[model samples]
Target: MAKDILHMTYENSLTFAQDLDRDDPLRHFRNKFHIPQLNDKDVIYFTGNSLGLQPKNTRVYIEEELEGWATLGVDGHFHSQKRPWFYYHKFSKEALAKIVGAKPSEVVSMNNLTVNLHLMMVSFYRPTSSRFKIMIEAGAFPSDQYAVESQIKFHGYNYEDALIEISPREGEYHLRTEDILSKIEENKDSLALVLFGGVQYYTGQLFDIGSITAAGHWAGAIVGFDLAHAAGNVPLNLHNDQVDFAAWCSYKYLNSGPGGVSGIFVHEKHGDAELPRFAGWWGHNESERFKMKKGFIPMSGADGWQLSNVNILSSAAHLAALEIYDEAGMEALRQKSIRLTGFMEYLLNGFNLGDDVLKIITPTDPAARGCQLSLLVSKNGKAIFEHLTRSGVVADWREPDVIRVAPVPLYNTFEDVYNFCEILKKVIF
Candidate 1:
């Protein structure tokens, strides 16, 4: 199926996009989402990178918990018929594990993304006098930058000296794998942690996680990833890659509602190891949690990092979304994604827009990106973005100039991609 989609030819026309949609095995999945309407027509939603469209079952999922709360009261914690609120976090584990390529024991659904990142760092970022520096991609999402910097400061080190941000070469939009490895080698001794976004939010570039993790490990540094943009948008093998740890939010490609519960992965190798972490009752060994003991006997695996009990309502929504993923399968979704985004790129390149007016900062190679394409609009950038908004195209605009658009495979169709480019072309011309 993947090979067939990869080798298929594309044309610049509405009929072609429609035909592809007609044959798309996942096409019916679109109806499962609540696509925003504009004058009774579905808006071209390309901001799945920022916020995923709501799953139609999201309300049903949340309502079940609400109903359980009303009737069961406090007893719902242990007695809810469908899903016991006490073990709510465990409900999504199997599905999430499949999405990220990990054993259920190595992954857990818990706090928000940043909070989980800090928690992971607390355990993984054990900076020593000689090995105190951390490495990250330059121009990473602001929250990641702040988190890494704060961790450095918390360790009594200045970010300027202790943070090593790897930037792309002049005139290049993405980092070369060789450059990343060389940078790690050069600073092997002082590097304490090698952290990076699995897929860069700005440029839509998917880093070589396995290679990076191997390099970081070889350099005697702990390796991790902020998979906010990579989690469900692309295929991942976190467990096999031997990634020390990873954390990602569900609000993006995972289709969980806003501020949805985040997920964490701890390689089985360190799952039971004693590590520095902020603990709470939820993370304590379940068998003895009610004993109210002073000692923190953490539950094994990623659950040990939990700081609090799961938020029932939000997690219900998360589980609702994960159900869809489990049925669709990540491998199938990835194959469709490659074809969908490749078609988008093929159409965009057809515009032959001058470099002065617009530039696609995202890598052209399908292997290096997910569904998003970041356009660097040099002239009238904001005006162009506004025009897209007025035309009902939901895309994200980053700082002084880039526009990010994602043709999410689960719901967004090839026709949506073609229409978006058509809308973009009108404003440019």
Candidate 2:
């Protein structure tokens, strides 16, 4: 059945992608990635929200570093490759800054997700007598809750007092900006920081970041975001929005490979703020770093937040991915994403699969979301998920019930979504 579907010369299948690709300014980018092959067929890959498909150039990028290590030995730190190991992270800084709408000086690619979150919290989660509460979405990613809880304990405050959760109203799948703002206003005197995921990992809701930051500031609290599911998935103007800080992993939407190095952003306004942070040798002034100085004189910008030297291998993958992003600019990619995802919604509704079978939990408005859609299965969610996997429809499932299907604009086509919907109808009915 899967074979026949793939072989089917349906006009909708070819015409949809052909029409979009014909006018698609970013259509050529599909060739840059290595889509997975299964049984001589290109598997329908709709899991970029969980893990992105690797870029073909990633191998060449890694090979260059390997050859440099073999030839230059220690000297590879300063020579032997297109980008030196010593300054490899710098290769992608400008591109990353543009992706996140930050200044080059305000962004640095470094450690993985949770590690960077802890580091940012150390400096930002300062709890005093009266104002020490931290506000976050109730359904935040599990790791985020753990980090926030641990930070509160480190400050000798009970979690109950230090943590404020903004949850959706009863029986609702998404949160409202008005509700979040109201919570900040209600607890203005006690709120210390407003920290949230720029896009909720489970619900696929893109929070109103700029408005959230303004609300936090009005209440005399700092603002930050965990961009793990947001960066590369959406257009984030971090610098222009004046967010105090943000951190995101490159593995998922960024397509840097699983468990890849993450990036951090600090607004230029706080570049010289008198905030106490945990420091280490790598953050020392570059000019005097090798001198083995006595005290840690941190660099002035986001690089100062680094606690150790960059991990060359992991950073190399990120650099490879960023090159692809640069070639196919974000604005162009986002334009395709809207059309592709809108088509997914259209097809799902076209199925006319009774409401008792499947329901979409993600927000309907395009402005409130990204490429991913969270489908709430009415029954046998796990079984259906396994069935989809067996059928070569690659998606991810959350606990209890919810299947996430993300059609990444960079490598996915409208035909993929069209075929996925056809399979779903057959399986459900």
For model 1, give the 10-residue run with minimal summed lDDT.
1-10
lDDT of model 1 at position 376: 95
Error of 2 at 304 (Å): 0.3
Deviating ranges (above 4 Å) for candidate 2 = 1-14
1-429 in candidate 1: lDDT tens per residue? 356666768899999999999989999999999999887888999999999999999999999999999999999999999999888878998998888889999999999999999999999999999999999999999768999999999999988999999999999999999999999999999999999999999999999999999999999999999999999999999999999999999999999999999999999999999888999899999889889879999899998988888899999999999999998998878888988998988898899987788888998878899999999999999999999999999999997999999999999999999999999999999
lDDT scores in order: 0.93, 0.87
On TM-score, the candidate that comes out on top is 1
Error of 2 at 413 (Å): 0.3
**Residue-by-residue lDDT tens digits, candidate 2, 136-207:** 999799879999999999899999978999889998989999999999999999999899999999999999
TM-score of 2: 0.95
TM-score, per-candidate, Cα-based: 0.98, 0.95
Best by lDDT: 1
True-vs-predicted CA distance for residue 4, candidate 2, Å? 34
What does the lDDT read for residue 370 in candidate 2?
Answer: 90
